[model samples]
Target: MLRIIFWKLGFEWAMLLRIIRPCSDQRVYYFAFGANLSPDILRLRRIGVYETFDHVLEDTVLNFSQRGFYKNHGFASADASVGDCVYGKMYLIRQSDAKRMDYFEGVPFLKAHAKIVQQVQGKPFYFYRSQIPLNGLKPTQQYLNYLTHAYRNMDIVPSQYTEALLATKVLKTLEPQDQTGVFVRHLSRWPKILHPSLKHYEKHCHQLVEALWNRSLVGWMIRV
Candidate 1:
């Protein structure tokens, strides 16, 4: 009888626990290889950014592939490249922020999420592998500025990576003009404060990197 009563009590405890904690507030670790790496864009727009770190994505290469998020054409995308590493930022963010990032990355339309993007800390790190068809797409200099700025600011990126980025050949198409200059100026502005928000400041510092790392950007730059 004591064993039977104990079993019942344990079952009830388990049920109660589930009822009280329907779900745990789980955070997500996300990696960014493109303009999303800009902290200004992540914070002012994407809330719930918890923390971040500079990381190098292994066995992958970065490039401007497919049309941009706005229509800037051929935005930054990544593909598997043997014997190469890509520089990027890893973020610890709210799960909701990760979902919103899906929208930003056009996950619903792109069908890119098959599995966790890559492994980190012995776990999967969700990411977007942008390998859209590349055909005569070119990124604006303003978009380019964001990337170069990021590199200039962050010493994490190797000199050769910056050189390879600047060396990428383009078809020299009638380069699409954009107001990215104003947007870049806005994101680069430093806040006047004694103790800036770390996450916010981290974002600022991230975007503060020289523009050479930025080869493409969101399509909405047309509206900037």
Candidate 2:
């Protein structure tokens, strides 16, 4: 009964709201995409994490989400139809919590680096992104590898502010190819990669997979 109730509450309502450290972590910041606009999400975030402003990067985008850039890569010219924006979430978690988020994102696919961007409230904050842009991610080879790893490791019940951002419709609608579809395709094809603990998220995982395959799923689309 408790498990069912907990699932109903969702991660933002559960861990994020209840898990935040007291006195505010100061290092943490909130980045909302869409669903996060719900008062419940914000209230929960306030409870689970610290809020902060002041950072190195200025927010160039006016909308809710921020971009995680890879410095060395030229703009992706091959896919013109591809959406101009790539979507991601960012938060200034302590190095300790950062490690856990990293595992969920698969640091191997997403290389963390220091970056600054504006939050929903127009405040500057720090975060990271995938290194492949600078390192040259082979879409053909790396895509499969990344998708595989992400499926196995990605935490559907996201704990970070960015996770909420990625799932938002804003990013999904703008993607050139179906972003979520591509994401789930890789995960479904690969099994035995998921950790044992994620058994709890299995239903959510199947839902994502089905959503991706059906092409009927709904979410945000980025504009650029």
Top candidate by TM-score: 1
Compute each candidate's TM-score over C-alphas.
Answer: 0.59, 0.25
After superposing candidate 1 on the true structure, give the runs of residues whose Cα lies further than 4 Å from its correct spot: 1-24, 69-72, 110-116, 167-224
lDDT of 2 by residue, 146-181 (tens): 223333343432345334333433221222221222
Model 2 lDDT at residue 192: 57
lDDT of 1 by residue, 66-115 (tens): 45423245666666789877787888765545654554444443332322
Q: State model 1's lDDT.
A: 0.53
Give stretches of model 2 more than 4 Å off: 1-26, 44-124, 127-224
In terms of lDDT, the poorest run of 10 residues in model 1 is 215-224
Let me know the TM-score candidate 1 reaches against the reference structure: 0.59
lDDT of each: 0.53, 0.30
